[model samples]
Target chain A: MTPACVIDRAKLRVNAERLKTLCSQRGIQLRPHVKTLKSVQAAQLYAPPGSAITVSTLAEARYFAAAGYRDILYAVGVTPNKLPAINNLLGAGVALTVIVDSEAGAEHLIAFAQQFSSPLRVAIEIDVDDHRAGIRAQDPELIAVARKIDLQPGLQFYGVMAHAGASYGCFDISSRSAMAVQEARQTAEAARLLGEQGIPCELVSVGSTPTALVDIERPGITELRAGVYATFDCVMAGLGVCNYNDIAMSVLTSVIGHQVDKGWVLIDAGWMALSRDQGTGSHALDCGYGLVCDAKGRLLEGWYVAQTNQEHGIIAHRDGISPPSELFKYGTTLRILPVHACATGAQFEQYHVTDDNDCVSTVWPRVNGW
Target chain B: MTPACVIDRAKLRVNAERLKTLCSQRGIQLRPHVKTLKSVQAAQLYAPPGSAITVSTLAEARYFAAAGYRDILYAVGVTPNKLPAINNLLGAGVALTVIVDSEAGAEHLIAFAQQFSSPLRVAIEIDVDDHRAGIRAQDPELIAVARKIDLQPGLQFYGVMAHAGASYGCFDISSRSAMAVQEARQTAEAARLLGEQGIPCELVSVGSTPTALVDIERPGITELRAGVYATFDCVMAGLGVCNYNDIAMSVLTSVIGHQVDKGWVLIDAGWMALSRDQGTGSHALDCGYGLVCDAKGRLLEGWYVAQTNQEHGIIAHRDGISPPSELFKYGTTLRILPVHACATGAQFEQYHVTDDNDCVSTVWPRVNGW
Candidate 1:
């Protein structure tokens, strides 16, 4: 099988330990987002059973919950239709916390709370950098939403949380460190506002891979959340958050054919295997779809997957040099480091865990879809 | 649940019927590529059992073969490593046809064919428009590669096949029609070249969704191959190959929240649900990610999914108009017609086949990995 997802367990452990050490040094609980590698087996190394975890979908929450992860945070903003599933998780003795960033969102939860036998734990998502979803920390609606959830008989206002998603754009350490501090300050400010309004916030959460690894003290934040760091990608490397060697996951593909005159080496791994996440497209040194590597996980200098169709990837030199005949011989297996780990990892149903000897030590199955 | 892949059976049948009628009128076989909707159940409508079909991966070949599809064509260029899987299919009595475009590719097959008690069927891929993987139609190597496969005792020289992948770039009917003719002529030319060398070609295949839809007589082409036509997409609509109404597949998502100041409405369907294929980015009307539609699949003019994170899609108006609060109310389900149907379709494990009234009539499971 040429097009297979491979995970280097040695590199994965190193990446996982790096984050754990950073969070421990900062005296903050690390709630690893299992959304990257939605495998109970992979999570066992970092976010073991009984450890708090963050998930993007209810499916991951239920899956991890069944694996004995009691404290879970469904990071994505919750909708009314998903309430029954959340209630079901609560009924199963899982301390699941759902996030809301709008007053209308709170209203939906408030209306659906009546059917809940157990109170649904809710958190107000604060917009630290106006990145994606979340309400502004200074917005009056933030306090209104928190009050609504706290007043609802079937709801428990768990805390205030924020993700500095904009931190991903910071190319240098100083900027990322500043973004991490701002994320903590704004989220803590939201909690401070809630306290002034007689709403005590238990957990103040903030993070993103770049921010979490920034080595800055998140003053009021009790917990940190980051996903892609568990398996660093080209995007993280482009942002200077990690080195390319730290990337744990890659797509192992065999050289299928080549377009000699055009200097193209076609492989079996395409967007279907590498994912179409060109996360480093805007960077100074763009790693097209992914950075190309040897079968043994060694980086092939200046080579990357430039283009991809559904089932074909074109590997070309960044400098337009023709591919060497010996290296890209027919049936030669090559590893492609993904541009985005989470997106690429989601493409496969399982991960072939490789040991230091590049032997398949184990196969880890992962959950996909909602 | 929101963020599910939905297929309108009515539209799907109409699209299938359109292609079937065209192929029937032209007196050619239609070997529908099952890569878009990998479900054997879905293929039963367009490509039914006993009908020759094409697959992207060996997993799909084995899947459809188990469902009684005998004449399977492994379309992607075969590598030496996959020969065992190919042998397994042949051993199971599948009339599987593998393709090769280079001498090295043929050599790999020639060496591995000795292991098989039965001969391996091999086809020479003709590069019609220098689009992707294929030997140029008139290249001297085309005849050389054909002779090599024919001379090998363990291999049977099947025929010539070509795919007009460049036809996707043709934005008008006239241009696409011309590309279609060029595709047919070049592929047929390769078969004719093989015929002159005392090697009788068994098949002459040429197609692409745009090329297959062109109502032109493919003089020497024996069969037409297409995949996305079973469920047209925004890219097809952008190319004038099909209408948006003809797109049968969509990602059903609920409005999770809104960034009112930014005129953005966020949905649960992100790259994880609707893949990161921006195939229409170069078109006159770039459907960012995908075009928006109502829950019942009515096109919402000017609305498209502008950006996406892992599980969050930001739907915005092309004209920068604010979202109408009434229509985009919290938890209101909406449909998104994908930029590329095959890419979006692959993101899901199963399709929620919807009836005329927008109710799910059945669930069709699809094969994912190789």
Candidate 2:
């Protein structure tokens, strides 16, 4: 068997139920981004008809649409090349919603919608906390682009959308809450500004994994989109949002070699299986390649290997986690706590779903490519 | 096409010929490690009688042996689980060799050899620089292990082996040369010490990309086992071992979106296509994610991608490289210079070979998993 990616079904169910309940009490739509858990089974767990979803790529948007998810939002800024695919989905009776950031994008999308027989719903991406891809809320160009594109016959403007992606960089809960509040305010203000121009939007959306867990009481954020909550990782743990036990997915690895003198244990899992986007490595507590666990999912105490290769992970004591009662033996199978669930989960083509026991219950194939 | 991985045959041929010539000048065997390339076609480029090659895994050893390259060495330190496979390879009339550092590993190999009809060659792995997996130089237990295992029928002690992987950490010519020297001396000294035990070591191999590039004057060293030089990357470029021009492999990516307000450019190539391994990030110059280029292979000046998601790369400029370029239009295909060639190359299953004119050539498939 390929060193299959394992997902804890119980943990995922618990996470989804918790988030769904959280949104229910706050009167917000919990549109769980299925990108983090790109499984039909996992998607079906939370993808109800009215459950709005946020997708990064059109491939995902189409998949969810085919699976009966209607209110789909392509959260990333759409490009000219991908317009045709979006048009096809919209034309095929899928209520496809997209995000636009520039006048060029708005114009390109508006023109594309003109070719279509029906209107295309789109969210004008607003700059929130992260300076990644969005127009500033107060920028004159934002209103101009919106007005010009909304004036186009076939283009339907749905409101402003913003992602507090930088909220993930926050070290404390107050900082995350502040970022979320600001994101909600900026998006709401943008909607009000557009409303003054006689344009009313049905939905306003704002989201991020870090901001999702906060007491979400922000105004005008009708929908919430979060992905990593299904499977938290080291980065999320380092942020103090979730504990290591809350993480659902882990890569199973085997010990291949040992350095008797240096007390270094080498495992077969490398950067290929465990991704190298060790974003949390630069934090105050740098977990080496990953947090190591024994056969029964117990965190190995007094031992942490700090370096990795393509197929080999070196293990040693970093914070007095070595010199335990039992040293890792060759052929011992272990699980790696992934740093980024989204990135590490993308490494494998499928997942081996495991329930309470360590037995593989079922297999779930994943979709890849753009 | 999902922006297939491309390998430069011309560049690989140049690097291969250069390494072989350097070794010949110093009267050492150029046993190119097939672990890096993982291509049967690439392995044939250096095959001849006694063209001893090193492999990182038993699967790799089995691969090269089946290709009729009998003088194979599985360079990774062996444990007990691989005994059957090693014995099977020997039984199949392949001159299989393996490395062992612990008594348990040596005993396992010896027991397997006793069960097999054909003789198995074993090499002692010496801790040359206190890396990860090797026995210490002055360990008295090595002699006891060797004595207990060598005369146990159908087992022949091959020699001593040491890898100078740490040499890649060197930043300058002198430091690199010093590292190579360190690798060579330790490997040779261990071989001499073992030979004094009447082991009659026939091959004393010491190698890595850095050591193979500069050092050829190690006492008692008989062979070089470097592999990664086939496809140099940003890490090797920073180490001054190979220039960017010498790199033979790159990922062809496409522009998916652009965001001027955030100073970011999105591409189809993310961690899956272009791996998140930033091993080369902290060198003298940090190549953000990777080096960027246009569709036709023209270099992007003053710009680099700062971070990457699963399937989305967010590129930005430090010195204000024009965010708007004609070549960066939607769906523009570009070749990304990888950060670590071995790690990045392993992420893909197949390679799309193209000549200088960008004409598609033959596809090379690679083996994955343990």
Candidate 3:
């Protein structure tokens, strides 16, 4: 299929089961972020009815809502361009919740709610540890916004929310724990701040994939929004949350050409197939392009795709590593581990589910477009 | 337009004219490689009357042939999956010239030509510099295969063709030029070898974007194919072909979020908008993500996007260099230069063309799904 993406559904099921067990053991409600696996088929397997979901864009809320997902949270700050779409989906009987940070933006969402016959649910985004797209944890603006929402017509202040994306940047447990602790504390304080202002709170969303796995308590966190945990990548592998054995997605490609004299094995998978995601470069180890794997799922020992073109991939043997074969003969099918599963996974419209036996069981379609 | 690809038509026209003039001065025909721009609008502009065009796939050959352009050369090694498409295109009065390396592949094309009941022009690829594809220069088997093609029914032997793509990997001009000279000499020898075997050889194709503008001399070379010359990029900039000012295509995106503490700015132009091409990184200097530029058509000072997710980009100052703005305010438009024009340009279905004055000129649709 043009050397595009292929997902392993069986592996995804295993990953889902593992994460659900992890959350159950820790007594945390899992509200998986749907941004990673955008396919309704895959989402249905991980998040069934009564299972909460987190969406990055309102467009995704409409998509999953049409597919029978009634409860959804727009994780990103709602924009004006998306208000009409959000209203239509809500009017159609889907329960929607959105996030906002600034007073200027939150006032707009509140004003839009006034026009609707039905009320709107929203959460104030608090800056946890990563100072990105959120208000300060101790700012009076948090209570001020809560007070405004209390007085605004047709608007409901759901609670406080925060994203711990900075946990992925950490290379060790002590550092990740430090970041995760800051994440849970800041979100907990913001929720308490709004709660102290006589505002009713419904949810306190605070967790990323890395933070979800940490053995730390999110005291005020009500829902965990972990998406990429469904499809582990090299970045996750480097963080020690998931091992190489847990990766559920890869790009299936074929060896189409070669630069033998220069020790380059050209494959059909370039960034189009396996996205040029360098997320794992800062980790203790760097996976070049990605971990080169054989058709049988063994890592191509000593082999690394050092250079690439638009449609062509050039690979060579790493130092002290012996190549498996003299040449990557024509029509050699291979699987490449992605740097970020979400980025690479979005490029394809369907997933080719290869089971533990490596036999394709089914094909699931993914949704795209605005 | 959803932060998709934006093409500078004026600059593309300028690059096309510059390359055409350079080739014309050297008495060489410019056969623009269609894989670069891939847009019909860009292709039509580069193509003069009866202009020879180079394509990497049979689908491209057919697409161009149906669009009324003839004299097409399928540059990539012929594959079994593509034989039928090539045969049908040849039958449609298109002067389809295809390449052959292995005897089995050549015999397969011969069989397809016989079944189609038309004479197909064929060229034997000679390994000039890059040992990526093409047969060896002094291979006795290569000459024997050329001879057999002449005796075969429904096929016309043209000449030899070679591409020094490896020269693009050469950071120094002397090495790149030596690679060019080697390509020219070996390609000319392949033609001489074929002529010695009583095969009528005419055209000798040898050219690359890295060498097309500098080492233009190839007395034995008859035709040249340099497509990337039309839309230069950070990769071409590293090759010393064109500067950042000459890059004709870029992705126009808006800043959607930022992390003021970590100094990380998230742009809407993720890999989906900028593409996953890292071809420009292999040079002496790596263009992280790409050459970051502003909405007003100037390079963004000190701001380089170092990381990206599916729909998110993390822009930071290079080497801890401080930026002027602490916040990349929501909805600030930006233009991102791609590392490879060919790969990034192929991701979009249409281009929003703008003039030098930033005025909208025209919209051009690209043909894909071959």
Candidate 4:
């Protein structure tokens, strides 16, 4: 395969170990979100011994459950239609926990859970920084929703979880650290409030890659849930969350043609292969599509994918330093450091994994779509 | 399933019929590109009996070929490594025609073909308006490359093809029509020049969704190729190429949570489900990620997806027409019309195809990745 998702196993191992060490030292359980990997092999490596894992889709939950993952967290807000699938997983002895931020969502799930003999575990989603989903941490509904879970039949209020998605917006270390503190504090405060209301909120979870890696303080937080740290990318590098050398995933591509006069070299890795994610666009240094590198994963000086179509990527120089035609001749193999590893990795069906010396070690299949 | 790719079969059939009628009236062969649909079911409905269909990836060629499609055109510029896959299809009695624009590309294919018994068919890609790939129509290499293909052993010059990609930049019909004219004239001119050099050029193809739909005049074109028209999108609607009512594909999602103060309804269809393709960003009527619609596919006036995360989409009123909280309460099902059909379609593994009556008749699987 010319244009394929390539994973560096060595770098991935390093990242996984780094996260494990950080979480272990912080006295918090590391529930690596499987949404970023979606690979059974990767999940097993990231969360070995069947530790609690997080997922963004029901498909991922089923896949991970089938692969011997016992403790699973469906990180997204649970809707009514997905209850059957969740029930099936829970019935199959999988400890599947769902999150919701509204009374209607909890009531809907509660009504569906009534038919099941086993109680369905639930978590209250709290808003940390207004990034996306969840009820405001200080909102009175936070207690009301938890009470609904407690009062409902065949439902168990597990704890509270909050994803500080706004941490991604912070490119500076201090800002990201501050967002982490706020995430932990807000989620912990919500749990504390629920506890004061006679609701036993046992598990308090808060995470995002930036916060999970940068923050050393965790007051009441029990578990840290983060994804995309195992396979870092240009966005994380721009955020100063990880070194560029720590990026394990890249798009392996080959040059097809070029416009010599315009100093444009066309490659097979387009948006369909790389994904149309400009996550680093808001950063001080915006990688057009991604940073370009040689086949050995060495940076090609200042080369980058300037533009992309459905099936073609135009690689150009950032500093107008167009190299000789010999450097980018047709059929030359190249590697692209993706802006967002999660987005780019989702574009492929499998990853062509390589070892430290760039030797093909294995090909892992990726489960995509819900 | 929430956050699922849904196809309006009635509108899809209408769009297919419209294209077939237009091509039939113009005396040109309709080679609908399968890059958009990537579904064998949709391909049969669009180009039944495999009448020279176009593909952006070798994966699509193999998929369609397995489903009895013989006349397949690998439209993107071919690289050396992909020749094996192309040759595999050709060896299986599939007439897999590839496009090439550079001398190196042609030579590489010629060398690869020498290892095989059968000659490889190729089309010389001519640059229509410097949109992306291809040699300029008037460039001296146009004839030189044609003669090289003629002189090279194990290589057959099929004809010339040009994709007026720049036609997408035209938001008006007149400019798009003019681009179509130039596309046809330039590609036809390249074919004529090849003929003058004792090289026989049979096929002269020129197309783009905007150009194919807007251009009725093609003096030297033998076939028209287009992809996105069969599943129109918000970008097409913004370009005045098709009405919003004609779009056949959407993301079926449900309101999970909300930010009442900001008037934002959080949905499950994020960029992961509906791709991060902001193609309509440059258009006059730019939809943030996609246009909001009801479950029945009726347009929600002035509503759009404001932002997206991995698995979360924030739906808000584009014109600040915040309706009552009851209208977008949690668990309410809604649909999102994508900005680019091809980009969004690539996100799903299958499409939940429904008819005009909102009845899900069948589930069509899509061939993703290369």
lDDT of 2 by residue, A218-274 (tens): 776778888888888889888988888888888887776676545577877666677
| TM-score: model 1, chain A | 0.99
| Cα TM-score per model | 0.99, 0.87, 0.85, 0.99
Worst 10 residues of 4 chain A by lDDT: A42-51
Give the proportion of true interface contacts each model preserves, from 0 to 1. Answer: 0.79, 0.42, 0.19, 0.78
Measured with C-alpha atoms, the lDDT of residue A323 in candidate 4 is 56
Scored by TM against the true chain B, the candidates give 0.99, 0.95, 0.95, 0.98
For residues B1-370, could you state the per-residue lDDT of candidate 4 as single tens digits? 7989999888888898888899898788989999998999877778876478999999999998998989888898998888788778878888878999988887888778786556778899999898799998779888877888887777788999999999888988889989988999999998888888898788898899999997477888899999999999999999899999999999999889887777889999999999999999998988989999988889988999989988999998977766557668888889999999999999999999997689888999999988
The top-ranked prediction according to DockQ is 4
- Two-chain complex of model 1, DockQ on C-alpha atoms against the true structure: 0.84
TM-score of 1: 0.99
* TM-score of model 3 (CA atoms): 0.85
Report the lDDT tens digits of candidate 2 across residue range B55-143.
Answer: 77676777767777788888766656667777778877888777777776776666667677687788887777776677765788667
Give me the displacement of residue B275 in model 3, in angstroms: 3.3
Q: List the residue pairs that clash in candidate 4.
A: none
lDDT of 4 at A299: 86
Docking class of 3: acceptable
Minimum summed lDDT over a 10-residue window in model 2 chain A is located at A319-328
Candidate 1 vs 4: which has more DockQ: 4
- State the lDDT of candidate 4 residue by residue for A198-262, as single tens digits: 99887899998999998478899999988999999999999999888889999999998998778
lDDT tens string, model 3, A1-370? 3464667777788888877887788798899988886878788668876678988655578788878888888876666556677778778887788777766566677667766556678788888765456777788778877777767777777888888778888777888888888988888888887777788678888888888777776787777778998889888998988887678888777665554446666676665556667677687767777777787566766676665555556677767343345436655678888878876776566788787788777887766544
